[model samples]
Target: MAGDYVRLAAYTGIRRGHLLRLTHHDVKDGFLRLDRTSKTRTLQLVPLHPKVLSVAQRLPLGISDDGVRASWKTAREACGLEHVRWHDLRHTCASWLVQAGVSLHTVSEVLGHSSLAMTRRYAHLAPEHLADAINKLT
Candidate 1:
């Protein structure tokens, strides 16, 4: 269950609070419909990664914030990753997408960021994309 929670966080890029409120109903038509976002209080839809779709189908994930925190603490300590925070899972999702050559604009949308600037931080992860763009001009 805890592993499912971590996978959902790392796959969807959903915030902890939003993730806690997620229900099976949110997983529809290949997208996770977040009706109420913590920051914007607006709807956001994130396409479900194929690897995580099965996990998302089992939502309301049956784990509380405390449960997640406790599990994260234990797992991190056991793995000597005490410095890692739960939110880093969200970053992991974004970083993976960026490193895969997904545009930052699309990544921002996937993360439901209010502005493109918020996604720029991940641009550095895909410097090859920049090189490809410049190469196109030659």
Candidate 2:
């Protein structure tokens, strides 16, 4: 149950702070509404995948930011993933999305990035897209 929050962060790309503040009520109509965010201070709605929604719907989702730290650490150790941090989940989400052919512009929006510059870090994962773009010009 404790680890669910961490997984939610990964699946949704919501930061730790905003994720901690998320309530079940915020998850309505297949979307997660972030009424407050660290970066923009504006309400942002991120579409929730059905798997993410299922796990989220069952939990209270009100755990403190530090509440899941010990569980997260334990989970990492069990998986021999001691090098990973919770924040890395966001990077994983973006990376997965980019690899799956989702556009950087859409990924940036989903991650609530202020600009495409921040999302560009995942650009390298989509070399095929670049090649396609270059081929299209010919």
Task: Write candidate 1's Cα lDDT for 1-117 as tens digits.
Answer: 888888888998988888888899988999999885556898888999888899888898787889988998999999999999989999999999998889999999999988999
Model 1 CA deviation exceeding 4 Å by range: none
Candidate closest to the true structure, highest TM-score: 1
Q: Locate the minimum summed-lDDT window of 10 residues in model 1.
A: 34-43
CA lDDT of 80 in candidate 2?
100
Q: Across residues 42-134, which tens digit of lDDT does each residue of candidate 2 receive?
A: 888998887788876665655555668878888899999999988899998899899999999999999988889999999999899978988
Q: What lDDT score goes with residue 58 in model 1?
A: 87
Which segments of model 2 are wrong by more than 4 Å? none
